[model samples]
Target: MTDIRWTLKSKAETSHVNNLAWDLQVSDEIANLLCQRGIKTFDEARAFFRPNLKDLHNPFLMKDMDSAVARINKAISCGENILVFGDYDVDGTTAVALVSSYLMQFTSNVATYIPDRYVEGYGLSIQGIDFADDNNVSLIIALDCGIKSIEEVAYAARKGIDFIICDHHRPGEQLPEAIAVLDPKRQDCHYPYDELCGCGVGFKLIQALAHGRGQNIEDLLPFLDLVATAIAADIVPVTGENRVLAYFGLEVLNSKPRPGIYALMTFQKKREMTLGDVVFIIAPRINAAGRIRHGQHAVNLLTESDYKNATILAREIEDFNSDRRELDQLIKDEALTQILEKQEEKRFTTVVFNENWHKGVIGIVASRLIETYYRPTLVFTKSGDKLAASARSVKGFDVYNALEACAEYIEQFGGHKYAAGLTLTEAQYPMFKERFEEVVSKTIDPNLLIPEILIDDEIPLSSITPKFYRILKQIAPFGPGNLQPVFISRNVYEIGQAKCVGKDESHLRAVFQQDGSDRFVSIGFGLGKKLDLLANQKRVDIVYSIDENEWNGSVSLQLRIRDIRPSSMG
Candidate 1:
């Protein structure tokens, strides 16, 4: 395993930390965390800890909110058939479900459409638009995609269908000629917060429509479960308006969620769910609907009103998730083996292709490859006559920009700086791969090639009182911008012998303590190879996040050790 670089965040001003700590009656450690999150005052801290729906910005403040709202209302007033079109991913499907369900309150002509991943690829597909035409749809609301479908939007226009696009991806130079193009990332857009996911953008449109209809904000609360899921699944920043949305969304998800969401919860015991649960558990199950079968299943599940029907859909999605897991692991192993056999480990980037690889799982596999190679990765599979790929980037690197640099070889591409998808002809794959590696090698900072575990602070374990942990827990709904804080403790020594655990002995379990601190039990997944370093009572520095463990009717705090290394002093 490659060693992870531990970079501790710089301390906030001492006076600010001390003042906040005194005012909040929290440990300096907690105060510093708040300060790092840009919360230096009592009011800010209160707002951060207690998220409020009222904190959400007025939807009209978006670049094209007025236009988007007017178009939707016009369609509703006319009783025109309206189509809600979206991509076949969690973000897109959730957006479709959210917007389409909201519109159903005003009119019954609303219909939802999710393009097949394999047949339609992504974004506004001709098949989807043709379906709208066949159904006599006069208005189409595109979500999570359509930011770059300039030509496709024209195709819809030629058929007398007006489009209202609610998307979050970076746009191409020319936008689609829609009735309204709502994207915070647009060059001309000046929305106060620009980090909303696709479903969040959909939520804003509904917020505007509701405002125009004089509906109370409470009327929209039920839809937040879907928003929170998208916010988690899309990996957007959990700060500002997004923080408020996610905070309330989590509340709705845990209590009185839509039947579809309720059906997906398979935990043995009911527990207070966190964003982590949404990311690792709920998001994957929802995504499995799209990846293994069809994304329409997810939209159906999210929009289902009956619990029994939702459960049946949820069961089908669960089976899809199982099949997806099998394919993911199998392909990930094969890709890794290819890298070794081809001796491509030393390359600046990883671009592997196989004609038979499943398109649905290549993105997941690309992310898995990064765990070992720690480089920009692209996993390719044959899709029709062309080759399709999913691109994943290392921290601080922009894979999208690199893709742009190699745009000549790409037939189509879209995504954020961290993750993207692209398609190209088979003949162009070699050139694209070579150009991509060349582009990343020359432009990327060498430091980014190594994985970084950014530590929020270096605090002694003694400071980890129950009260401190309580306050820290409030600093969540954690994600990209406001990540769960990681801490580093130095000169820690193992008290009990460390032992490998889990399947294939891939995890390490041990008991450790630092000078003047209580002993902590730690579980380090994927750190089993480092167990030898913990032997012989050698001191070491550890990076970890505090996690709660429950077993045999007992609960205790444990270190979810992220990385371990020998003590620098030793």
Candidate 2:
């Protein structure tokens, strides 16, 4: 039932494993994973282990930082009404919260604006501009968006408003004529790291402004919690500057979280938090505000100073998250049924549509669809006169480029390679769907269609110990690029209690062992149906990541099983 291929690193790369192991005094298995992650040298290993705030890149190194800082300072001095505009998603709302909160420290003339998803759609809307105009706002700092809003920026420009854009999205052929466009992705930009999320970009702007004011950049460390959450939720690579930010951000979260974050965690009992915790716990509650109600609720929660007010807002957002879960599951079930009824499972791509589907949860539904029919997928729903859709691609495929190929049928599309959003007239949906399938089937690498589990190393269960796990725990806040290490144990046998557990008996729990090795408990979430694979204590190969499980006031190392099969099948 498992077809995951186990990929090992090149022998040349593996050769450094021993040297790193000797240098760091860690096991060869851990060293192999470190070397594979490009941490071969002692200095690299040190930097990886110690993510210092001093290691962050200079904010002014980004192109246009001087101009952005100068213009913002002028607006603050003159007391010009300044507006912060951003998207409605986690990245956008967090960016708004970050920049607006930072600016309010210097001047009280700042205001934040998040466009309504259903009403104004995405990016620089004319309605947002009109609101700024009515409020006598002379300057707008656009975050997360406005990279491709050439016309919208010009619209604000003609209305006697200047714009400073802090964005990370790819620029269009014709760049917007804003006062300062601060995206590192611009062709002329020489910013070393181009992968900063929207909030990260906003943080850079804050850094530049602080430097301009002769203030210590360390004062801004408190805001890294938001930047870290955005980095995780936005799914940016956890490397270089991003890693540094997240490292300190986790410290901030665990030590002295903002009142808003404190309120969000009021119900959570866990004292220490990781990047994974931010993604699953904090991101969802913040995102729910935008999905079920309005994004401003999230910004309010982030910016609220009073703990009591933030607690009330957090509870409100929690209700929205609960509603989102119900709608998300219902729509996913309906989309699955639609695919089966249409008999389109054999197609190279999944393109499902229903006019009545909730537009708010379509992106989540698109991701869920891939589990049942693994391929590039798009979930479409009627958004007013246009049929808006969310696109999600499997690993190693570029959904953004696929959308570009079908641009003739699309009204607008924008996002990264793995995820994107677009809209088209209802009449063009069928053609767009056909064209997308054709483009993907022709262009996508055949091997990418199958999901893969890239094993970091092969080790005996005996190699795992308390000290090994203690060192592994140092690699906190894991995400893309620097994933948690996964190891394969070959010829392991089920020693005792291999049975289904959890609700609906959907998980497998067992104790596993190999020749002359101590038994290790394991849990295989969603692998209950594969219990037969352990029949009669057959020799098995398991791919798993080590985890600490606490039970009955005791702690022990356990394998969080990724995949398992009989040794013959593996």
Candidate 3:
């Protein structure tokens, strides 16, 4: 068992909730949720629910937007051979597809390039520059990468290739000398929203180019499906401009999906899709190309205009995804065994390695390990002459900072607080692992090691109505920073039936009520073992999210239980 904590929000904000609810003619609970999301006034609430495209800040407001726009247009005017380059991930591949497809509408001189993950590694590579030089490409548009590629950019410049970088990762101390660097995370950049995924940054550059030519924003709405996929896959914050983009992107996906997306949807029985569907279903298929083989297949699938051709590409990617899952599970199981055999379970951090492990799935394995270990984790695999690793951290802890403290043993490292990538000499692995554990143990807050369940509000079972459920879903397109609200119901007791469910009896299905109130049905996935707690207890508190279940042409509210424990009040 693991430690769990419940953090309740302050009730002092209820008065503000009441005022906003009265003004907007909504319930006090809905108003409370709105205020919690920083929507205090009626206007803010309206804007939150109905995001407008005009509300998007002018692309020129981004740093270096003018230069980037001018450079692209000049390339088009001169008919200079332009290459769109990017990393071999979903974000990078989608960014490449977006810009290349958009520019192709204006000029036939455009081409796209994605560096091979094994050949040149990540970001702008000298091999990519050499390829550009040989093709007589005078301009290169690098997306999702090149923010830290000072030497590569300079090398490309010497070869008569100008660089326009559209990246969103945090920048280094000294910027690269490129024709234009358009990253919102630069300390000097004042873009209102800095959490844009790489494709979102690429969209802004194209948006600026369109505006410069006096084109309508509606002309570019078709591309939002790609932007929305990137936003969800990259795990960027779902607030501000991103929320607006995702909101409309879902519409495009549902109403008039691109040929490629439509082809993928044919495999599913569902008629409508959401951001979560894109993340779990579509994003994985795209990412599979990069992980199991090359990302070019993903680009081809995204940009293909013919439904028949896209169907063929989707089949190939499906095979890649199947192979990736097998490898991911195999490596995870091996890593867990290694930890047990080495007796490192008591360590503050998890660091495991195997030279034969596939590098493509290391990041996924790192995340999988965290679900069981619940601490900072790193999974290492042999890459060329060095050992490369992917790092992941639990909530509230900065694995990047821990890596920074142990930078002496690292050859190269880069990424954000929650996730990062690093490489180190084979001889340095032991020292690096030791130092990482020490740093984390000494500096990490003890409470952060335990998992947390944030309860948005405490409500009774009677408060759950069709109207309440309807209003709750309006705040969707949920992700980080705008998570699905988790509500806590106290003094709940089993009413009719409680038993293990599913084939292996790994789930729990029950009916619950409080203070002889209305009965409500709930299903707890993977909570079958908790049946003993309910058998011995009279009352319990449950943390759950309200879900609407539609069965046999009827709709009713269902509680999706997240966790359960004996009632503290009792």
Candidate 4:
């Protein structure tokens, strides 16, 4: 049988459940979860439950927002050619789509330029700048990148071209000489919500443009569907204003998705969709463009106005996504094999470099390694003369700062606390890798290296009712920061179990008997391995979320199992 561990909420946090219950008008069970998440005030509770777009922070509050908006408005007025330069990832491509579509209403001079993931790597490039200069593009809007393009921005400025940066990545000690820098993380900024993704920041810029042009904010809500997709795809925190954006965005996704999104959903045979649909069905297709081909295809798909062409493009992207999954799995397997052969000692950190690994999929490989090894991971692949690496870290570890410690060896780097990217000369990879391990070994606490599942709250099987499940559904469209509640049910008896329930062993269907009176059905996706363990156990504890399962013309409340472990059979 597999080992099982139970984690209880701290006593001090649990004690505040009553206060949370009174403040939030929720049951003590939900209050326990809120208290565990450190939500103490009523305002925090309201913000968590009911996020309103009206409460979004002012766009001008971001650093350099005023200058950035002014430059763009001036460009529109003069009808000068402007280029929206974006990264190749989903966040960057969606940022480009949002800003370019909004700007297109004012001038046809605006166009989008997505860097080639295989050829151009990431961020602002001199070749791109020179091309824009050659085309006489006077204004450049850098999205999802350019925070650390001090030299590139300076070079563009020297060519009489102005830049307005709308990046959300971590910044360096010095800022670039851009017309306006609009990152919430800037020290000088006073924006209330700081966890915006690149597309979220782009939406704020559009908000500023609408205000500047005397346009109503309602006109922009439709585009929030794209913003929400970026926020979810980029894995940004969904608290505060992000929650509102994603909430309403999901509505638009289900009701009036753009032609391209509609085509994608049709191709996937998803007639109805929720936020989960965007995460699983839509985001991956958009991401595949950047992973396997030029991200311009994604921008085109997003901007496509014809339904027939959108369908074709959608199918094309679907094929790309299929190919991307295969490539990712192959690379992940190879990388895992290399890690096992080289680092079998299980070092505190994993640093793997393969000359043949696909650079586009390294970040994903790094993330998978971090999930499996429960340690800080850096995956590197050969990129021209330099080695490009993606770094992912556990909570409480600042990966950007960790990269900064080895700045001398890194040619360039940027990102947030948990994820970052860098490039260094091929010759310097060994030294950088060694120094990275040394820094992490010395700086990171040993206890933080192990992975621990954070349980939200415990609920007895008898306490689960249809009304409670409805209340839980209202708080959905969940993501980082705002997460789906994970309820732990202790000492549940296994009444029945079904093997290979879904296609390709996609899921396990089972029934549980609680107190020999209440019966509930559950489905566990990717949890098929736990079926054997459950079959051997007389009683078990399960962690799950309540879901509404729809069958042939019928709907019923069901448990979506997360984890299952044996319980004492007293």
Candidate 5:
């Protein structure tokens, strides 16, 4: 529906692709896509296609793992009350659910804590420490957050409570003085795989404990469903160990999901769950508890053992999700209107603020703005005395670094290259906005402003055989590092009458053939306005990902169209 550049991915080694294709007995297209992902040899391809649990790196390899495990073991032996604390978002709540449940297996003294998004803000909050201290908890296991909570960690220490942190966010220059700080991203850490999400990190800790207890890895299979959801929700790279976790996690998710997950899945049709389904369908509902209510509700539901109770909680969370959706859409429209009213559409970055905006959906609103404005975006709302903002960046640009350049205006901020959050006084908002725009304008690569799609390969309709699709489908659990392949097909002709569908008539449905050799059904969501490309029997080019479409209880291969335009060569 919008202009986009289609670029072929960087070519892989030619000899390697041909040799691998011969060995694998598949098309060169599949081999090339694999090679581009750094899969060269047969062994590498084998491991990639079939991830083994034994392939997972030793849990003890992560820095401070022994210390963290030792402390947790000591607490369980001493019958100490342990507090599990995490952020309010999906990664955090999932981590809390995982670690708290795992610890509960050894002792019943474990308590899970999720900070109030509105009241306590983010990370290791002082109020959470106070709660831990009041409850006679002697140890606190912080998950997903606490990497940058130096003061709060010290605060917990002063209260005679030891801290063990399991986090995946990038560490600050100074590490917290906790009893154990388990973060793969730390500079001194020697963990082989650093891309684990918060829940993945939590998974490693429990894996270490189970090893100490002489528990077989099979005992941990039930927990994979939670790890997979966190990995999907956190948007971590789906390569290396992460893929293995996601693979097995999805297996558990489909086979024997927890009561909480099973309850949530009642809304989805009975089918295998993918990373996309977790991201769009499940994560938001989990996040909605924290956004619209208290994050503790999410932790409650995730750890609920009874299916009927979980269903009751799931029904409540669904209402929260519905409220979240309305808030997101309404805030997005308001933010867009603010941008246009301010005459700032031509700016290098989007900075919009509304004191009346709901703090929960500002991040979603910031993301929606980028789709319309196609630039770095920040959405701000009033948070008590100061103004809190959620920041999102365009592809290939580091919004975190841009915020760093304007650090003088920010009270505190943390996040990755693409997403971040910050707070500042209302008085400094204008300067921060101006300085952020200037920083991004000077530093961002000019080409990153335009959206682009990386095409894996160009192929004719005949290349898509049933066997080919069957093998291609093995590349499951796709995310950032490893993504579902998109292909470009040129000189394709429409074979049937095209029609606009959907409630808004914004969807395109048609059948196309190449050289009259094959006619495959295709559906392009949000491409109805471009139906002119098929008029007068004009040949057109298309960018699409292959998918299975189910209609009338029958399933067939279909091209999920990404974009379509008149053939450039013809």
Candidate 6:
């Protein structure tokens, strides 16, 4: 299960050419990728490469938006108490920060509440509502969650409190009875884009606020840094309007980062930041708050009014993230053992459980199992009388829908297409597991069980140039659907080979020559095991991403090697 082989499939160039000819000003390979991604016209290509805030659809276009905005405006005007309730993940924390900070400008009555990860679980809870009521809060804004909380929203509504739901998760057949349920996934929603993260949706709310106040939208552009971080961290597709948000968000992240980000950058030694930097360095720190403790730590860090406090909180979060990494690795190792022991079944799904596994890290563990096994995975741990589990799906399988099939056993569940969370009674775990496996075995194509590494395009090593790399960089803030361009070169000769080292000789550095004309340096992290295969072969094919690497204060263009194999002898 750990050594799943990835196969490369190359589509004919004609189809790619036909797809890109109308829009891209590039060679056939780049155009093919653009076309394959449905960028068919010049305008579409332009917008895809350069996302702007101006391109974000009017927020008022969402169903119930008018009511949501009016209620918020009334609260601001009347000086009524308002509470912002959010989940405990990065997306939830950023959404809470976006809405609460925006509202603080008009009224001090606004305060934020983040559910304790260990104590309260996710979304709007009756306890949260009662707390808001006790504080005399008349308005509640639920961010990043609450799409499926029909009961909780109804309870809050009955208490003479109004609710506004700004969420991105898929809603159930019956929508919540909140005053305004603003979700793009709503069947009636006509918003042009449907792939926003929770924080991205929150950004739209702020955008609407700016428009209502007749304020310049540019004034809110700085906040894109946070939106971009959430979009990247939440694993949302960075295409369409999200691309624009993350594109501008990265610029703000690198140029004029707020205190929280600045402190994180300094701590991580990330002098120059990119979307990848945010994904790898900054995001884990932000997420560590919810994983190891309460997400309020993250919210406080994001909205820190004092510079000194922000620095202290950033360092504290970094330590927490480090601890989380250790815990995640430990749990992942243990879960892998449990999975391997049951590999004889050859099943299409993996469901592993343990009594004492940390509830906070089950999601992370499930994600790791998915990467290794390339199957729909669920990691469950005992929680009270029920078993709480986190589920992750492969490319074609929808874990949320799969969970719905077993809803008879599930006490509660919510998440996106790829990731979800659920709770079920301990007595029903075995039956639900068998039913889930049966459902997946019947529905999933057997071939998709193997992980596939999709190469964006095939290219000649000679085709790579500074100009081409520059064009590629313009498609910044790559994530999920909009990925950093990957290129495959065939029949490449190994000019030189050595295990250039980092973090315990874990990386391999080498030089490659194609057609005996062009030589390129390539570095493969954790590919030292392939050193012998690379050295013995005279030539090989490589999958790589073009990058500029800075080493010891020197910069040079190089290939970040992804995978390689012997050249086809045929």
The TM-score between candidate 2 and the true structure equals 0.98
What's the TM-score of every candidate structure? 0.98, 0.98, 0.97, 0.94, 0.98, 0.95
Write the residue-wise lDDT of candidate 5 on 145-248 in tens digits. 99999999899889999999999988989999999999999999999999999999999999999999999778999999999999998888999999999999
Residues 152-175, model 4: lDDT tens digits: 999999999999999888777899
Ranking by TM-score: 5, 1, 2, 3, 6, 4
Model 3 lDDT per residue over 1-570, tens place: 356788987553867888899988988888888898899998898999888999888999999999999999999999899999987888999899999999999999988888887767778999999999999999999999999999999999899999999998889898999989999999999989999999999999989999978887899999998898899889899999999998988889888888777877877655678788888888888888988899888899999999999999888888999999999999999999999999999889999999999988899999999888889999999999999999999999989889989999999888888989999999999999999999999999988878888888888888888888888999988888898889998989997599999999989998899884778889999889889989999999999998877789998888898889999889
Q: Is candidate 4 or candidate 5 better by TM-score?
A: 5
Cα lDDT tens digits, model 1, 427-513, are 999999999999999999999988899999998889887777787788888999999999999899998668999989999999989
Of 1 and 3, which scores higher on lDDT? 1
Clashing pairs in 2: none
Tens digits of per-residue lDDT for model 2 on 1-570?
136666754533656988998999887877877877888988999999998888888989898999999999899999999999999899999999999999999899999999998888888899999999999999999999999998898999899999999999999898899889999999999999999999999999998889877878689998998899899999999999999999999999999988888887876666778899898889988989888898999999999989989889888998999999999999999998998899987888999999998888899999988887889999999988999999999999999999999999999999999999999999998899999999999998887877888888888999999998888877766999888888888999997579999979999998999898899999999889778878754789999999989899999999999888678544
- Per residue, candidate 6 scores C-alpha lDDT tens digits across 254-292 of 898888888999888887788788888988889898888
- Per model, state how many residue pairs clash: 0, 0, 0, 0, 0, 1
Ranking by lDDT: 1, 5, 3, 2, 6, 4
lDDT of 2: 0.90
Stretches off by above 4 angstroms in model 2 are: 11-15
**CA lDDT of every candidate:** 0.91, 0.90, 0.90, 0.84, 0.91, 0.84
| Cα distance off (Å), candidate 6, residue 86 | 0.8
For model 6 the TM-score comes to: 0.95
Q: Name the Cα RMSD for model 2.
A: 1.4
Root-mean-square deviation of each candidate, in angstroms? 1.2, 1.4, 1.4, 2.5, 1.1, 2.2
